[model samples]
Target: MSAENGTPETPAGSTPPTGPRPEPIRFFGTSWVGHDHGYTARRIALAAGSLAAAAVACLVLCLAYQGLQIADIGSFVTLLVVVMFAVCSALAFRHTWAGFSSRPDPDRQASLRGLLTIGFIGSLLAYAFRCLIEAPGEKLHRTEYEAARARHEKRTTRRSGNPKKRRRP
Candidate 1:
């Protein structure tokens, strides 16, 4: 210990050995969130479509269940069930839509955004209709379109206030 002053050293001019760096952790259902193959896009469409379909299916199930028992319409909880199903279904569809739509076109041959946009809107409409039928007088969950619409309205309001001078050119 006295001879070297007690500190261990790495080999001359060489760094100490290290294990490999840890690989990144990929979160479940997030890695594929932005993929743009046609198949992937179509699957996304199917997923969203299925979610909407399932909500309707659940409504039908509720109706059938009620009728089978000869339950009174007033006593039937179809509306509540349908509303719950619609809300859950819409949320599932939104995730699928955003995943496919948010992704860039992998080929870059054309913008896939348009297709994604249409699918997204169509899913939205389908979900909205389903919810409305189930909850006619109730307000939407407001989790769906409120923030986006509010931002758009704010931006538009600001833009509208701007004065446009006559173009001298």
Candidate 2:
């Protein structure tokens, strides 16, 4: 109705149109947007819980190793078992940590399933470590969600007031 395109213009004091709501992250609900509603407490609890679980798992593994020793298993075989677990754990930790920020190759992930399964403790440790710093995958999800919101806003914005009112060539 202004001296521009025929479509009615929004009042200057009115709020802009909102984009779609963000998808919530697990255990975070929608609190990640503002870091409110017990977000900090949940992060602390999860971090401590995961760390404790990982510690307990390690203790059980240690006890198993001791049983191997007490069984008079060959020293060479015991050492090999320890080395294999250590290497596998290291690899699993790296993979799990990297996965928080990026999507891993499915083929590679499938190939590593056995190794990862054998090194579950490492994955737990990685989760605990990341939770201590920030909610697991929070940053990655926040960035992607924000980008999607921005794209939605851009796409929905009225670029032209009325296409039908344009002059023909």
Candidate 3:
């Protein structure tokens, strides 16, 4: 068959061949129960982005609560806070990237649990949502596996020929 329209030569009444295996979705090199890597990366990126936004919001609220102008904070203190935020943001970004392209690293994953704690919290929520997303895909995989197995059994049975036909002879 031509590469563009490649199809398996399944005989009539046989199950159609399935396409390629599904990709796993992951964050920090850990897969979501049923998502592919690409989907997992996007989800992690979103979580990281929201964490940054939360940091900014908290900073604003802290300043408002203290009734202190930005100028009232010492330059050194402001610099330290900004630097810390930057480090955490960098960690979140790196964790998201690692989910997509690298093998699982337990050390790095553990560090992220501390540095990107909000990511952990958000991931817990996302895990529940992923079940909804993955349900259909899981069903499809099961159906395809069953169909392939049935096709294999049918082929083997025919190749061996009917036992009754041999017994009659």
Candidate 4:
């Protein structure tokens, strides 16, 4: 039987469809519900800025709590934690943009990874903390972005360098 829209309708007696629900698309913990590169970039950059701000705020709070005194044991410990998270977050942010690019930036990635390694060595605790949130997502996005980019490059190069165009007069 056909419905008012001229499309066939499933019989009422038939079993309903069953499958897993689609996962919601999210950017930086915020659901986009739609894809737009500009919006995505803005959200990603904002997250980076927020992390940097958190690092500065931590330093300020630590100082205030100590009545603006010199570095002590507690302050030193706080510095390590704050620096670790801040540095990692900054690297993650830079890598996020690199991940989004059509071409991968190996040098940038290497440098950032180096910084992350240093931070990890300095404070394993904070590095672990930031990695818990950033690493998996970054890796997944980077892979997906690179694969799509490679495909695009392959298609364009084949199209732009046609055999007909290479014929000499």
TM for every model, in the order presented, reads 0.24, 0.80, 0.35, 0.27
Candidate 2 local distance difference test against the native = 0.83
lDDT by residue for model 4 (1-169), tens? 1322222245779975432222222333212223333445544555565556556655665675575244455767767666665677566555443443335567865766766553332233333333444432444555564676677667666765567769797
Q: What are the per-residue Cα lDDT tens digits for candidate 1 across 42-102?
A: 4455446646765676566668767845765554476665455455556545544443324
Note the Cα lDDT for every prediction shown: 0.43, 0.83, 0.49, 0.48
Candidate 3 lDDT for residue 31: 30
Every model's Cα RMSD, please? 20.9, 10.3, 12.7, 12.9
lDDT of 3 by residue, 74-95 (tens): 7677666656655665666555
Quote the positional error of residue 78 for candidate 4 in Å. 1.9
For model 2 the local lDDT of residue 6 reads 22
lDDT of 3 at 119: 38
The model with the greater TM-score, 1 or 2, is 2
Look at candidate 2 and tell me the lDDT of residue 15: 79
Worst 10 residues of 3 by lDDT: 24-33
Candidate ranking (lDDT, best to worst): 2, 3, 4, 1
Instruction: List, residue by residue over 1-169, the lDDT tens digit for candidate 2.
Output: 2233222345899975566555566776667677777778988998899899989989999999999999998999999989988999899999999998987899999999999988888899999899888788888878888898889988988487688999999
Candidate 1 wrongly placed segments (more than 4 Å): 1-69, 73-76, 101-169
The pairs that clash in candidate 3 are: 24-36, 24-37, 25-35, 25-36
Once superposed on the true structure, which residue ranges of model 4 sit more than 4 Å away at CA? 1-73, 116-169
